[model samples]
Target: MNVVPDPITTQEQASKERENLLDFFARGLICTTARAVGADHGEPSEEALTKARAVADDYLAAYEEWLVKLTADNAAPGPQ
Candidate 1:
């Protein structure tokens, strides 16, 4: 009947996980952007740049939504 999980603790752990995922996603985006710009021709294809930017923007938007949800979830009562 002891050592049970608590709301604050669980929320903290979830937040940590979110931060970790965001870190990797952001790192990958940076690498992709670098590769897109550092082409051998010294010029990247417009299509490639567009695709890369679109993916990066989507990731950013998703991260923002996740952050908001995480905060809102932690604010809830009960076991969380």
Candidate 2:
């Protein structure tokens, strides 16, 4: 008979994977925030429209950075 892994082991593995994925997103946000605002980040000083503009203005640069990170992650050997 083919053996199966324990459910607890599966769950722990899933949880760790989720944590690693979240960390990747958190890193993106950190990099984006650092670029959009000063290092000591706070609430956006501008209104929604302006904040929207802020992001729009640098959309390509941010997109490139995010894409590079995502591609690197995708090519990673296995789950972190």
Candidate 3:
């Protein structure tokens, strides 16, 4: 028999899933960054490496902010 899911439970599950996905993406980004830097013979040029790091940092920061907002929204009470 099919069971009906509770709305709050469903929302919580969705939020958890999103967090897991974000974590996976963050790990993948780290691996990709390492490979990209390693592909250069010896160390990459300082300027290029610096730029790449800045971009990665910006993306991570934005993602963190987004996560915080999402968590807050989910935690807030809904309309009656």
Candidate 4:
């Protein structure tokens, strides 16, 4: 039996995936920065975490913008 996925469910999955990516990126940045600064003892400092989140937000925004442009270009009609 073939089952078609609901559009809403697919959208939700994409949203969740983005959220997960943001988290992963932020965490990685935090760890990398901490190690570079020789502060990788335990948990990252509040300041480092904040900076990492900011960087992650900017990265995600740029990525989303590029994706939108790519999608729009692909959707445009070609020569008739």
**Evaluated with lDDT, which candidate comes out highest?**
4
Ranking by TM-score: 4, 3, 1, 2
TM-score of each: 0.42, 0.34, 0.44, 0.65
Best first by lDDT, ranked = 4, 1, 3, 2
Question: How far does residue 32 in candidate 3 sit from its true spot (Å)?
Answer: 7.2
Residue range 1-80, candidate 1, lDDT tens digits: 68865554587796775566655665566566677988344344566555555665678778789999999999999897
List the global CA lDDT of all models.
0.67, 0.61, 0.65, 0.81
Q: Note the clash tally of each candidate.
A: 0, 0, 0, 0
Model 2, range 24-54, lDDT digits (tens) per residue?
5555555577778767655544353354444
In model 2, which runs have C-alpha deviations exceeding 4 angstroms?
Answer: 1-9, 38-80
Displacement of residue 9 (Cα, Å) in model 3 is 27
Per-residue error (Å), model 2, residue 72: 32
Residues 4-73 of candidate 4: C-alpha lDDT, one tens digit per residue: 7555457779888777777788889877877899974677677767778789989999999999998998
Which ranges of candidate 4 are over 4 A from the true structure?
1-15, 37-39
Candidates 1 and 4 compared by lDDT, better number: 4
Q: Of the candidates numbered 1 and 3, which has the greater lDDT value?
A: 1
lDDT value, candidate 4, whole model: 0.81
